[model samples]
Target: MEFQGARNFSIESPGNDVFSSKYDDDGHVKRTGTWVTASAHIVTAVIGSGVLSLAWAVAQLGWIVGPTILTVFSAITLVTSFMLSDCYRYPDPVHGSRNPRYMEMVKNVLGGIQCQLCGWAQYIILFGTSIGYTITASISMVAIKRSNCFHKHGHEAKCHAANYPFMIIFAVVEILISQIPDFHELSGLSILAAIMSFGYATIGVGLSIAKIAEGGNHATSLTGVIVGEDVTSQQKLWNTFQAIGNIAFAYGFSMVIVEIQASYLSYPILYYSTQDTLKSSPPENQAMKKATATGISITTLFYMLCGLLGYEAFGNKAPGNFLTGFGFYEPYWLVDIGNVFIVIHLVGAYQVFSQPIFTLVEGWCAKRWPESNFMAKEYHVRIPLVGTYRVNAFRVIWRTLYVILTSVVAILLPFFNSIVGLLGAVSFWPLTVYFPTEMYLVRAKVPKFSVIWIGVKLLSGFCLIVTLVAAAGSIEGIITDLKTYDPFN
Candidate 1:
């Protein structure tokens, strides 16, 4: 189904006063949604399980360095997001020349195998990052319960699995639920997404604040809490650098090629609704710049708030839990009450991740399912997701399945070292630092540092290195502990 030919719908665009771009019978944009509630898309995409690590690092780096990362990122994002806002700048699609997308943009600017390879590489990282998050969220869920349960029962078989049931149930439920089609419009998912993000931040803030306010009792000594005090000076220096890097990485200013297109009068609808919005958006500097700017602002706000609050509560010698993190310390209760919300959050994340492919699927579906009732407004409403999905559903289905399976892995994997390593190296480094810039580089020919793209990559690299080293140290100690002590296994 080629959705490209379908008449452009006006309801989904960000420029809509109400934020709901739904069109009317005459194809007029809907004026209904007046932004009643704040959204979490900004929060969800930016802040995740990485907050704990970021929070800890913030404390180590002090209020200055930590906040600096966040503030700098926010400033950069503000520019990027506004530029993204300008993607609508071309007097709207109803007026004139539309923008091109990642492939098109890169093809236009830096055509060749490199951009193509980058396109493919970025798809992997973006989808992989999504998978990693799903895995981490699931793992945290089970681990939190198990950690608490084990502390009491001593790792008995009854509760040995740690959220095993939730994993099975959650994945199946999400799968079935996802099949139900949109709960109406993209905004619905946006709401769900916002909650998950807010929930994560809320919990972390609550825990950190509780611990910090309590003072002393919840605070763990730096050396003691981190676990390896007497490592070589190089390692120690490296660890400190890692902490700084995490801060920098969290400063998420990137040259986003995707959001820019959204602001463009001619950006493909798939860009906003696709499985890979970043990669799928128009690639021109105007488009890319706009996307990066939007990403920078929304993401920066989320990261900065999370960092500030997380640091407040968890920073500097503090050990506490966040909402999602709470599921780690107190699972059943947290899951029982928050799971519904958490489920929403996961769905939100899934939808956002699925967009890259979904948009493509939607695009294909449109081509395949040519509008029988062109005048029918529903055609406009459904076309994007279907079009993109049709183009990429097979991939989406597998990635979705992969996400679920990996989440299940989270339930089973429990080595502190592995967790830290994954959290730091696998999760934090890539998404925060590596992914943004590397992905953007596909279209970013000259790669200017002044651009958020440069900042994101530079910062991500800085963070990735530090996080990996710290994780490596922690993992090594765990290996040694297992060999010598063998506490339970």
Candidate 2:
């Protein structure tokens, strides 16, 4: 978890090739990542199931507030990302010690309670994201079935498919994939997930444009859904709050910025050189900043297109998930393809988010029970083509239980938009806005009561308020949905 300074490790190896070609100044493997690679990672991380709710979010806030909220959240993510990027190297931006993990950076810059808070916020968000992904993958699976049903039996036929079975199937897949060991093993999966994300997003945007081209007028307004005609005044207020949460969720990728930057380093070795060698040019912080800007810009553009165009296509009645909500029933094949892409993307994405938690808990258990075989033992199992595999009983049982728990939670609360909104509202300010701002203040030593200080504080305060109300609204939405619904029905 912690990286000692370069001076502590012995870098002198018996060969010139190892010293010259393999290691960096910091004793870790040489970093080969560029801003382009980091941007690609960010794009993959930032765009996920959250984008599916944007049209519904836009419908809630209407034309004026909808796009504005998206823009504002985008700006907030970019600014905070820049702050966290600079924190990657401490004391000095170019020459200071590298903090590869987010918690490590927080501990170095803003230790004590702040670091603990960051850890809690980060892990909670990751856990909640697993549940959200489960619900999303199931919905997509059901959508695929429903799309086929609609195509076969006419669009008017009943095509109700329970989400529970698909959710269980997805959870079973995750339980098996969860044994992949660590993040280093997930590089190919991450790339494929990123591609799938783009595929589905493009499909969504293309479908929305096609819907718009059909020239069907969708009633929309500057202020969102009308009170009497569409929703009650109370409902409108709650929905607006929930919509803000949805946007917040869409922009919630700040927690992993440090990890993404750290990923630039190939894998750490046992020893490092004592002498200061040349580092990757521009520093990780600088490259990460560029990546953050580029990635967020691209993500926001996609968000605007998908959200605004989908809103234009469906107007105030845009379903929480436009693809699965039957917004475009004619192109059944396209819808099915989009849903399939979603399921594939979420499969990889679920692992990406959940691996850290697995590592954290498993590491803690190993430390706590160093002498126990249950925690430290590995069993080798040989397969036909996969060759030998190492499996631990503790890992299998613990990870399986974790997957089952998340799946059960998803089954209990299957409201997609509401769950997304709640998770976003719960995490956005604490992880995205407040911690990064505080860390930046400590790192830069900005004078108290200065203009920058006041502005950031104000921004953090406003976001906290947004978080509170958004949570309230999402909770209300869930409660409203629960009234007429039965769990496991």
Candidate 3:
């Protein structure tokens, strides 16, 4: 296969398979999963620390464009997710494998080089997201502590809320909890993360509505936020782009779709002993579609409610984090509670999102050091004299170091707005829009310039352009803001 001048790999090619499904001498058996489980996993992937900042995202655009942008992206995400799900399996099952990781799918559908590019993009996005979580959790902790100190000590107390010690402590917790081996093992954590997400969303919306009902004067529009009737055109344009970037970051979840699909054990045996082409069981296909729809719809509702109410409450004054935007006000306790949940949720969310990264790195390392002791299992006596447990020496040391490095970066930067925006601007289009669209076109054998094909290509082009502009705008914003904290500045 050829895409433009590049040599593409056929997903049905025997040698290009992602998953190596094993078979007994007699026949092959595959695992399958339920839609409900997939839906839960999707919810876990989509609803993360980003939700905390969506009101601030909405504040970037006025109420009119904010929700609209969100809805548009949500729709696009659903469409892309469906497409990607369809591409999850090779048409000729015996020739290939199922639930290829995102980059694996890219490799099969696009080419090896494109796969490598997708791999880099995926790592950057997920690593940035993990860093974003560290920043979010640390900052939320800082705010919670500051809120507590202010209530107890009033004006005389001084507190270093955003300090290294807190981040170290937070990082330690993450390092400890991040040891879960795979996405399938995260079912309980995902459910808890989902619940925590709902709890915080409810708290945010509840607080926002309460504040709005107080009948106080508040800045409500972009003009008011900028504080001038003579605001320049460039500033408005910049603000719009930044808002789009932020919303993109807030809504970003495309990187984890393949991993989520893989979590389903009911692996669709899309090919039969006789058939060469793909034909998924109707129930499996419909389950995935239904799960993707239901999960995204639920996520969208949570985002909309939080964004609408939080922006309505604080309007122009809204901070990047809704809980942190509360200031040292009357509801300090609720703010503290919300911030704690944010930290907890980010911990689980970080692990969920980083699973793919961990898998890739571990696989590469294991491949390189097939006989190393680091890859060997070591048993340790269990606490309370229960039993023995096995541990991976490499995983412990490597992931701990990974968490520590991320924590150091979080402590040094400690800012979320521009970092997340920049990351989203850099990675969202390729992962969420371009790759899926292109893969679908190729796999479905849709002819070039046909109506549906043309529309998809246009969308892909538009998304690519948007991400470039967004990256530039976000980078500029980060540079400008970094002047305040840039060590060498």
Candidate 4:
């Protein structure tokens, strides 16, 4: 019930007496809590905005090949998730704490240079998450304005593209909600968005299918787009890299998920203490494996609905968020109704942006000020007001600096495109392609491999390939786009 002599509250699995999992053989769930409960869904959250490009990615690659890569990549990552759990876990008493704990162990396994590299990768990933969430918030706002959701609610909506005020408003609102730092508020926002999204998509997608039955183009389902007018090897190469990069990123996040296994080791007690754990449970831990993947089931269905119905009803003009593409699929009247939820989700997206930094930074602060309890952590402290504020203030300043630095690098990136920018410019290499594999190797105490480990080695090699290609392609695309924009040549 206690970890490292710290009696704290976190999500714990149901007692081994009632329900248990093969992955969670121990009586208590490991390292489990609210974080673990939310971990699985975090992928969708991480991949949330990027899903907009799914069709484009598929269009670039062969139709069947697109999902094949995803499936294979997902399977490999699924195995790697379990593999990561094994590598990082101590079957006996001590558990590798979550990502940070795993990082520490990996340092010991790989030695100084590699450990530092791994640390940097994690650092970027942590911040990369912030960037992706921020971009999603920005993009969602634009999508909302384009939707009838704004008009129906009768909100003053206008062009948000290049509008600095809208961006600032969102950023400020996000900062406030983030200040709350309670699971209740954040999860409430996430759940509302999730439900509206999943719910609407299901209904719309069904209607779409019915429309198709009433003689729509069946070829949309069984269709392919041959983009890249010239069809050069470089374009093919770029497409391949993007696909691989997507796979590796998916796998990378999955590796992060196993730590959720250890995290939940303490969940039951934490939730029980609060009374009616089910009442407090969130999607990933509570709804995923425990409820037979219910949360993701809901999510996947929603996504399909959005993709299919949006595609079918709105055609190519499908708006990517909050039924913004209502005009694409149906009348603007739907957009009118959707306006309410759109605001709700802009708030949600803002929460997503604020949360990662708040939680991650607060964790750092807690360690620095270990002398203080929760009350002190929340409000004031005896440790010199300026000093306490300075420590906290420095974190905010540093994180902002890092965010700015990341944006600078992203802009500098040759491929201004999100996927390429992410993979090449800043985020991908450190988190997905590098950390998990190296951490696993480090934990294994060898720079070598077993037969099964050979599989990991090959997979890591593929990841490296994807990483290089993605980065290169992104850089190339950025240059091409820039040159085209001005045409100095």
lDDT per residue for candidate 3 within 53-117, as digits (tens), equals: 77877877776788888899899888987888777665632333554466667888888998888
The candidate that wins on TM-score is 2
Better of 1 and 4 by lDDT: 1
List the RMSD of every prediction in angstroms.
9.8, 3.9, 7.3, 8.9
Better of 2 and 3 by lDDT: 2
Clashing residue pairs in candidate 3 are: 31-265, 31-266, 31-267, 32-265, 32-266, 32-267, 33-266, 91-278
**How many backbone clashes does every candidate have?**
70, 0, 8, 24
Name the weakest run of 10 consecutive residues (lDDT summed) in model 4.
Answer: 268-277
How many pairs of residues collide in model 2?
0
Residue runs of model 4 more than 4 Å from their true location after superposition = 1-47, 91-115, 149-165, 178-223, 227-240, 243-252, 259-327, 333-450, 481-489
lDDT of 1 by residue, 1-489 (tens): 112223763344454445423432334333231111111223334554445456555544456656665565455445433333333212242232233344443344335664565456445544544454454445455555655665567545356444446556556655644543332345555555556656755655555455456654344332322335434555445445455444433442222333221321123222431112222224223333443445455666556656566656543443322343443343345433443454556665555554565455555666776663332123112455454222234443544665576555444443322344333443344433343344345433435655765665666566556556755654554454456543223
Best by lDDT: 2
| Candidate 2 deviant stretches above 4 angstroms | 1-4, 11-22, 261-279, 326-328
- Worst lDDT run of 10 residues, candidate 3, spans 269-278
Where in model 3 is the C-alpha error above 4 Å? 1-37, 92-97, 153-160, 178-188, 222-224, 227-236, 261-283, 374-381, 385-393, 486-489
Model 1, C-alpha of 360: deviation from truth (Å): 5.5
Give lDDT tens digits, candidate 4, residues 146-214. 554455543454433432334455555654454443444445566675555444434445555655556
